[model samples]
Target: MDINYLLIHHDELLTYLREHDYAETYVNRYKTTIKQITDNASNHNWTTYEDVYQWYVDQSYSPTYLHEVRAIIGKLEQFHLHGNFPDNKKSYSSFWKIKSAYTKLSSEYKQLYEDFETQTCKGLKSSTVASYRTKISSFLYELQCKGATSLSDVTEKDVLTCFFADGVRKRSGSLCANIIRFFKILSESGNEEATRILAYIPNLRIARKNIDYLTDGEAAKIRQVLEDSNYSLSCKDRAVGRLLLHTGLRGIDIACMQLEFIDWNNDRIRIVQQKTSQPLEIPLLPVVGNAIYDYCINERPMSASPYLFLDSRAPHNNLTTDGIGYSVKKIMSAANIRQEKGRRKGTHIFRHHLAIKLLSNGVPQPVITRTMGHTAPESLSSYLHADMKHLRECALSVEDFPMAKEVFQSCLK
Candidate 1:
């Protein structure tokens, strides 16, 4: 499509859309107006819906363009009155209206998101509140673009179709996930019917196995590689590898660790997990302790963030839980430890490795559950699979011959 469609003189287009008598109701047409304006430009050869969609995500566009976008929003207000706020209220389209419904989130929906913001991650830094709010705004704009004037007008399936099959806008699974969660929260919070409507969404990236950890041998190899190449691997990476393998803590738990939490005298680590809000006191295993000590002494950035992990790039910045996986990946690549193709070398692998190591060592299931800070024992399946290598190693470690011969020799003696 024509890239110029994105080059729409939003200022000129908005001045034109403002003239329509039904401008308030037509605020939904901003996307179209923007497209049409681009179409009318000099040497307008061609364009695709994708180009227009990309324009929405582009922040480099002038603020004047944003103001023009705001002017187009006026039509959605007008369109909503005619379509949704009627005397009868039965004309539901059931079409996929992401931006429209998200833009005007009901109090129930907002409350669910707010709960996620406050109860899930305090100070709003860790919460998805920022992205969710952005999603809401994007949803409204999308609804306006789609001419989605009423929530009742769209069906759940219609939303799915628009999200997946719509050639106009190619939404990633992550975006769809956010949209789905918004509706799910709305559904859970007294709008019981909203749940039914959202049931149709394929529920993107719902990690079936919550704790995916690495195998003991695999973890051991990673550690040795890091230790050998002391110059290439950071102290934090080495410590992370060791702790992840030994303690099986999640990235969130690791990021939350501080010097005060380490009770060297008692040899325990006290952490308040975000998911369960449960205070977990895990004993400091020797391997984990060694790694921590080495990292702290050799690599910890001298900064105010007190976080166990720090970004070397931004020496003063705290290590975000978001970057934990990437950090693991970088170190893994540096170590030339691609034991498997297309498989990510991530922090979670350590947690799974611990589970496998425990189960294979004849450690009790209850103990394993508690050791890894798992809320339920049932969460061990993914770890079970990921630990296949550990199991094989355990099987191979046993010397199983001549037991009967030894018993016979003892009897003869």
Candidate 2:
């Protein structure tokens, strides 16, 4: 635990990391970084986290190298402080930049932003809150740039102009909806200006697009790949693929699923939906259960982390939603299932497939909505397009029209 122990026992740290399955190349890079820090610093007595951080800053390394050096030093700091390597991704520094930007807004608008953020954080997921904060912050910043000192000064023209800015058109509906919600929050807080602003902004009705889903054959192929012992997928990948395919869980739900969520005795898995914040209980089929069991027993990393899944590499941490999506894409590629243009290939595709399957089997819309953790029955309406059998049932009889057969024959001729 000595201050210079990291410098003195550098080789030992590398060996320990290697033993824990850290890639050889990464360990070598760590070695090089350690040498650089020891060569440049006057004293290696890095005791506190702040002390190590300060020493790194004083080195005046380039941004890229600074990040690299800081990462290595962080590992050493973790070892000294906690007697183990770090197990989570480092929090990004951009968060502080965002907070600073928020503090710089006009006092009235800043208070509005605070209230909007507080309301969002009450039940929204962290990712959703971050997105809302970024979009709303940008809107406020633009208003400030336009010399608008108060909410009343933000006219309809300003809102329209902002909507036409780059990248806003694609997300116009969602962006406008968020703005409406923000105005609603302000109006509820007794801001008459916000009530006026709300009248000017309309939530654009977005057209409902057809849901993309895997056909029975495509799903079977992907499931086969997951179950094949010779397919060369990592344990984590197989387990994740099966979980999405069988349980119809979203990527974020799979990412946040903890070990305690699985009820072994009851053969069910319970989780709070990341997007809706509603609790969901899915029956754990044997195929899905066996895949997860195999992973936990034979393939999962040996870590004290309570998450059901973790990164396969060293400093193992729970997978993120993006990581889960990447794994699903890899599984699809291995099965030779290339997603068609304009069709989504993420984990949500499995959910769509499951919903369509249930609909085809005569499952009620409300039941489908409940199973998928949807808050409204209207959310299940999109799957109607994917249910060809049900659509066929609504077809008009050919005999209803006298000229229908003659016209069909003439067209064929």
For candidate 2, what is the lDDT? Answer: 0.79
Alpha-carbon local distance difference test for all models: 0.60, 0.79
Candidate 2 per-residue lDDT, tens place, 213-298, comes to 68899899998999788887888889899888877898989999999999999999999988898999989999888889998999
Best by TM-score: 2
Query: What lDDT tens digits, residue by residue, belong to model 1 across residues 315-379?
Result: 23556676677667766776567647756576766666667777777788888888777788887
Instruction: Tally clashing residue pairs in candidate 2.
Output: 0
Stretches of candidate 2 off by over 4 Å are 1-21, 34-85, 88-101, 117-121, 165-171, 207-210, 339-343, 397-413
lDDT of 1 at 246: 65
User: What TM value does model 1 have?
Assistant: 0.53
